[model samples]
Target chain A: MAVYTEVTDEELSAFIAQYDLGAVLSCKGIAEGVENSNFLVVTERGPYILTLYEKRTRKEDLPFFLGLMEHLAEKGIACPLPVAGRDGVALRELSGRPAVIVTFLAGMWPRRISPQHCAQLGEALARLHLAVGDFRMERPNALALNGWKDLFAKSAERADEVAVGLRTTLADELAALEANWPADLPAGVIHADLFPDNVFFRGDSLSGLIDFYFACNDFLAYDIAICINAWCFEIDGSFNATKARLLLANYRKVRPLSRAELDALPWLCRGSAVRFLLTRLYDWLNHPPGAFVRPKDPLEYLRKLRFHQSVRGLGDYFLDDSATGEA
Target chain B: MAVYTEVTDEELSAFIAQYDLGAVLSCKGIAEGVENSNFLVVTERGPYILTLYEKRTRKEDLPFFLGLMEHLAEKGIACPLPVAGRDGVALRELSGRPAVIVTFLAGMWPRRISPQHCAQLGEALARLHLAVGDFRMERPNALALNGWKDLFAKSAERADEVAVGLRTTLADELAALEANWPADLPAGVIHADLFPDNVFFRGDSLSGLIDFYFACNDFLAYDIAICINAWCFEIDGSFNATKARLLLANYRKVRPLSRAELDALPWLCRGSAVRFLLTRLYDWLNHPPGAFVRPKDPLEYLRKLRFHQSVRGLGDYFLDDSATGEA
Candidate 1:
């Protein structure tokens, strides 16, 4: 819930004049996306999202995020298409920040994660992976293995303030993940942060995926692991294997997973859990008093990490019979 | 910038099912209106604002607020008309709070106010005063003279914390306003909070007025005082008399102001200043640590009150020659 930048009427009119979108009807600051200021801009043409990238999103990375959305949409994936100006440039400056207007997608993100939602999400996730296979842009996941260690270092001294043994637990997990991280797997562009809120749905079908700030080139199975942790968990800290089975099975129907990718699922899931835990821990310890956004509970990820640590093999995620006829 | 209530997809669908607004296509929480949870809901029929009344708005007052909007819109005023459900009821319950869908007005509030904006605002305000002359429902202003005492009582002990001698100054001002507040001077329904943000404009023309929760039965001149304090002050605490002259002159073109209302303007402006000062002081003192909405600086109103206290008559607001053409 953020609108960090305030766009004035004159500045907005001048900005919109660069585009073919008709006279501005209304532009409202929307309470979505924490990384930038977002406005639900309506014009004589229709509704579009005008985003002003803030300091959190590096200016150099705007091309990759904007280009990835364009490439994915051109490949028939359901996502917001960046609307370029009359000069054919999608990215421009507004209020001294990098800005762009993208066509608005129509759907509400599912608050209650149903098995059907997981199935739809699984298919969309696989399709996004396959769509971006040939795209030339490449951005390494900044919050990957090395980034986790850096975040832990920043929060390690005060980690125990959140939980009594959280500091030691994170140290041990970091060492274990460092030694056992997978060497090679099917790699492509992955939506590194595919939380349920980022995936919108219309009824039982997936409508679109959004917020590509964290999208990067990484192990595709790692994206699946992130989803299993995000969508397959209940409020009470229990994992629903049925949802996981549907997600994995539906994903495999579109793109088959290699044997090694299947075997590395547990480690990838654990790494995913630790990645979130470290970031949340860092935020929890550092968020200023009276901050607008309440930092999420880091212990939730700790609980998820414990579950993934206890997993014996792929069987723990779902029964072997659930994967019948799959690679 | 608030969306305090989270309406689920199922809850939203069920709520919209009560209306003729077609199947819900999208609903996004908008950062508008501090008092209620506002959503920009787009359906097959287009856009509307689905507002879930929060705790700050009393449930019992819902009928007066909703009916007033309906009444004003029917009288040809440019405002959001309340949309009734199929059952002919405009008010219903959503997320355990009284909710309603209002026709979406297409305009943006002026971020930088110009004298032309003030002129248009004055005309719209006078039209609003005339439109509500015959409305049946009545609600006394909750933040009027008596309410100011209650709010000061809550913050008197700490008023000095905001500024030296503030407590004594407030106590003396309250006594003076109690002695001088006009009686029997053009009373009717008044939009007591006509801040610039509540008025919308398209280019140079006034499009509509909104946030009617502050509407109530009060001295019509008091509404003018509120607007004077809101729209006539520059960001640097200086008053713009040219804008004030344009506002009052244009307003009189629609509905003439009585000589009594004109003479009472200075004291009414002082009272309006105290009204906001006490509420802001109370909020500043009582707000919990880490509150989401930062309490506004009470000193801003203190400066405005000081300026109004120094004014000798309407001449200080604008040249008397400016009102020569009007009553």
Candidate 2:
């Protein structure tokens, strides 16, 4: 863990002094992440996560991450609400790192996920999309359609050595996406990395969500596609059709996807694959080591890229539309 | 870039104090990597990379990563050779981070990878395996066969959400693997993350190997299986038969695999897929807010896992060996 920030018990208790919900008690470092230093704070008050900023994070961006949580919390989105300090500020300086405090979510990450959970995730994700649409702030998708090309350019000089065909494929895909990019659809800020860990739950009911770093403006349906790739799969690398259906149906219960979005799911999934593959490929080629940060496996994205290359339809990835009652 | 260590001009001059290599020159940050910070050091001595240790590394393990580079460089491998500092130590520390200086490598990562490049990589990887046989060091395969279960356990609660039959299928594989784990294969340290990014080349020849964080003890043949999954496919995810053949055949030239090893590729590939999928799943569930790190696409592993699920012969993947050539 990277200790991006340092905070003390007295300061924390003082910070949360005004919040009527919990009593202040103890605080200690939990884990250090690339973006923030996380401390587990136990208050006679309650449990909260104290985060101090790291190098990669700019203090200016804290409000977006913090305020979004507060906004979502008010909307019944089941996320942590940013608690303000004594001066009514949501952030503070600790260990020379930007710091903030938020409530800790409950629920163990599902290890042996069931297809039902996949379906539920899909539904819950749809709900998230609907709920957050009303939030006042907006952020454009930083990793939207053309992001892959920029990453490729960053590593293109050495693309040939990584593999012979990668360059040509990247070029071709860039062209294909450009030519076929979606122009109009439901738009909103999305929790782009809506995989299992970011979501917390108590039993079958969701408790909260964490990690809003990748949250940005993008297609509403694309977020669902990300969920399909993330939530509807088991640890064994197998896709569960039932769970995928459950997910889709659940989403429909909230804000139904438009036909354009529904029709675009397959292509969007491909884009999703491309997005991750490029980043993974970039990291692999660069091998930039950081403090306490581990490079993820690029092969997984490679496999996904390949699978999407051979995709026939979104139905194949999900099940038939009959999956959800909306069909 | 995190400056883990620095050899100021004065320090370099004093150290070379004795060596008379060249002029103390400019040190600049290199734009590469998601993990460690690197600098391109230009001295009358030549160009080198000054790396700062970050989070996912232990300084003590430098011997393994650095020594492997030396051993490979000594054997005509075109890789960075760890240079000793003024104190005659191969490593130095700056900014409280472990640091090392290495020669800069030149090459382009292949964009349109050809069968030839794949074949060459296969051959080169084989040579690497052979060279490491006498590594004179021992490191456990931290992510090998049985280790996948622990990763799955780390996030199995949501396993069912992935695929319908994933849980049961994994259960059966776990039992089968446990009951019939291969023990009598050629064992050695392997570059487990031998994906395209790790290998650099000028044209079709490999130039350097960077990032050895995942290298560990495991069956050498398993490494080959990993290569097939990585090198045998096109960017669009299609399996290139010729590429697969070239990779396998060239690999065999340096390290001929036994029948038992051949039979184990499917299981090994499956295990590899499982290993990556589990790690990726864990990351997906646990991303930190505002981290620059991008999560890998789990679908790729899902596809690879599916392919391995149905494997019945070497032919199924792409191995047709004859006494003379690849059958």
Candidate 3:
């Protein structure tokens, strides 16, 4: 729901002149992404997405995101491929913001996360991990354990405004996560922000994945942990174990999980929860009151974090019978 | 930049089941139009616009709007035609808001209004006035002189907050306009809000016109006057007489304006300016400061009104030679 930079018709006409795509028919600012101005641009050839990277999106990280999409798409993964202009460059500038045109993918992101969607998402996530294996770019997860403490420091003083003793709870969680974080657990390029909104579904099948701005090299299973918290929780903050089982089971079917990865699942889930909670807390405390974007409730992730803390072992998340033979 | 009503995928799928259009490919909330939640809905058939009318749009007015589009498109006007479902119904309830799907029109609304656009707009407007002659439904302009006084009354107390003597200027202008408002002018279904944003052009050709929520049976000359105020004014508030003459001459090439209509142009322009000024003033004063919508500056129209006030006669708007042989 953001189009921060306005692109005039004259600017757009000149900008599109660098591209081989037919004359711009229409360029509509889409109200879907918060980080950048996205337009569902239609031309004589077909519909494409024209994105102007806003202030929040670092210009340096764009090549990594665009390169990863190209890498993944080359491996037969369904994702948006940046359309190169006549000058053979995929990225250019428009409205003083880095702009790129990408091929449009068909399908809507599933609003209701059914078990079937979770199952498909699990397989897709595993395949994505396998697909980007040989890619050479490297970007560490910025919201992982390394960055959590700094984010917490900013929002620490006023954390209790959201809830009683929330600051202490976040501090305790961050301390525990930092002390016990796993050193090695099969690192690879992961779609670190694989929320349901980033996965598109056409009917019962998954069509593609999008929003690779958050993609980076991190623990592959940590990506699964993000999905566990994102997809397996209901509106009432109750964990749907069936969805977790389906997601984990289907994920294992494509790529076997190591014993260390299995052992690290609980802590990974907790860390992932804390990661989102910190970001959400920062945004909730900092965003101007009555802003257009309704800041997501951080407490929802806190409740899930508490749920992960209560889990006794791997058995709580995955029964032995549901396991597809972990490594 | 508004999608106040959220339409779920399940609801949309079920809703589309009643129509012949194939499965929903995608539905992105478009950042356009303040009155409705507009989605650029794509299906296997083609692209279409799904509009969910918000609170500002009265439920009773849906039929008239949809009916007019249907009538206009049937008469070969380049406007979005309402796409009826299998039951032959164009208007239905979705997310508890009156909704309709209309055919998608290509071409972006001109951001920079050129004289060519003005010429095309004038002829198109004249054709639109002639095309809707047989439309049976009748709706009086809700923001005409009848409604201006009430709106002014709402914001008159706070008018001085915007300017030192805006309140008195507004009152005096309202009085003069009430006394001198033309009577017995030719009236038809007028696209009363025909700003540059509502008219789309493709490569110097007028592609289509949109946003009919403000359309009603109003003075045809007043519609031209609204266009004159909208398209002929530069960013600095100076009137471009060349653009106005081109617009007027091209309009006469289609439907010649009567001498009374031509003479009433200056007054109609002044009234139109007042109509927009009063509404914008009301919105500026009454709208929540931190609300999502940024209220337009009413003083812009105030300046336009002042410009119209300084005009000596129709000659000030139209020069000697391009007078269309006016009496």
Candidate 4:
């Protein structure tokens, strides 16, 4: 059902056959992704994963995704490493789609993000930030501050369709966000989509990470902002102070955030939430029937944007009440 | 990508080949919409849209979506109806997706919702509920009660990850909701996802309704609850009473709400917000990356739920002295 692309098994087998994985034993499509075709492959040498590029993901960007995984894995990050062919290439075409073979990783994404899990994820993310430091690649953030305006342009015609004054409000926010976007800050490779689902764990212990499709060079603090929006809030849109604290505290353990990063968290969170909301709205209005996917309720992201909007401070939400209230 | 599955070039040629003709053309990969798959099928028959197999729409139920359009069209609804195929079937399968071909709808989803737009949507939805009464099909009101708990069960394993008392709080609310489930009230098919994207418009006039996937027999008041959540809230998750009132006032002009329905609106809104939050939460915690859809943050809904939960009295949010304070 997740077959958004036309990649077939035979095509993948032939593609990997060139990789000299020793010998291919079995290939099973692992329906673990909603955006791309993923498979578990066992070869004479070891187990690996074969990924067939799909829409949201471009085949040309396979090097960024595959290479990041390999770099992270080599640097002691627990993640899938794209295995190279005898010719030292990590990517090949299969079934009319770009494909790659990588070592398969284990551990389930935390279904329940406990305080401990929050702390663990925070630390893991920090470590990841540290680990990606040595990755030699240059990719601008795809969904960065400017991306919001681009999405808004697509949805402008229908912004009013979502709510009264949405377009005007969005326009105003765009101005405000633009006015406050952090200009000088530490930048590095970031796993932009670091939600619980993209993480792995074993018995309360962090296992590995996957999906660097949104990975990009951006403010480290911006990545933290994404996590805040992703992790601390509940579906009903209520902010849980404890969960927020756990996440921030754990992250600071390994990679302490700068004062500037701390100050930028609320704006970054707003940008992140609105970014997702705008995309959802655009898709909601523009979705094609043959869409292999369902559009999520953009209102959910709208709520998140609204929450960050009210947040003049991220202090009490995480560290101390007085300082956060002031922010 | 907007495949005209409801009516292919061949089918349209057969059906409208007899009617006033424009250039006949079709797109491929139409979305299997809940209410309709929109096809921009230009025909010498004049540009028209073709929708097929309105979903949740039984063969017998097609009359609701189809008939509603026809009825509204007669009353100047500005929407096309199910054009019969030459084979006499109004709905048919083409391009591996079900569809129907009708005149293409003009206008765009409004971007700036004013109190006016909210009021307009409110009136349009009520009018829709009233216009469809000529066709009768009985379906139960879902999201009535216990619906919240049922959803929670899907993510029950991780309830505690947020707080120690979420499970108990959710359980308590579920019990109360079940105890208070409305048994008898005005009933009809309601457009459940009436968020801005579903309503189309030109200038200030409402054009048509699309995406009836969630339409079903439900309490008219419950539909109002959905509107409250959809229209009366800002992106920051704050309640906008002025917009809510405008919506209700406009809706009442067309289909006046019963006093009982009004009494149920607050509970219904809470339930509506809760439903979205829980679904989003389920998606957030367990997204299979290949789904091509993004999972929304649950926190937004949670925030809305909190506001609803703390409504010591509903009158206060509306500036109505009679409804002020949490009930």
TM-score of chain B for predicted candidate 3: 0.97
lDDT of 4 by residue, B10-125 (tens): 44445555445543432222322323444444443444555555343466555556655566677665555667755666666654546566655544455446687787887887
Please report, as a residue range, the 10-residue window in candidate 1 chain A with the lowest summed lDDT. A318-327
lDDT of 1 at A246: 83
Candidate 4 chain B least-lDDT 10 residues: B26-35
lDDT of 2 by residue, B1-327 (tens): 133333343344344334334643434343345467665544556555667778767677778888888887888766678888655777776656777777766543454567877878887888888788778776787676667788777767766666666667666776776676677888888888877666765535666666676788888888887777776666566667788788878887777777788777777777777777777777766657435455676667767777777878677766674444444
- Better model by DockQ, 1 or 2? 1
**Each candidate's DockQ:** 0.78, 0.01, 0.62, 0.03
How far residue B299's Cα lies from its native spot in candidate 3, in Å, is 2.5
- Each prediction's RMSD over C-alphas, in Å, is 1.5, 25.8, 2.2, 25.1
Off by over 4 Å in 3: A289-291, A318-327, B288-290, B318-327
**B120-222: candidate 3 lDDT, tens digit per residue:** 9989998999999999999988998879999998998999999899999999999999899899899989999999989988878999999999999989999
Candidate 4, A33-137: lDDT as tens digits: 557876555566655777778777876677787788888888899988887888988777776777777776655566456677777888888899999888898
Give the DockQ (C-alpha) for candidate 1.
Answer: 0.78
Q: Assess candidate 3 and give its TM-score to the true structure.
A: 0.95
> lDDT tens digits, residues A1-327, model 1?
778888988899889999999989888888877778999998988889999999989999999999999999999998899999999999999999999999999899998999999888888999999999999999989999899989988999999899999999999998999998999998999999999889988877899999999999999999999999999999999999988888888888898887788888899999999999998888888888877776788999999999999989888776343334362
TM-score of 4: 0.49
What value does the lDDT take at residue A9 in candidate 4?
34
* Model 4 stretches with alpha carbons more than 4 Å out: A6-9, A22-25, A44-46, A316-318, A321-327, B1-327
Give candidate 3's iRMS in Å, 1 decimal.
Answer: 2.1
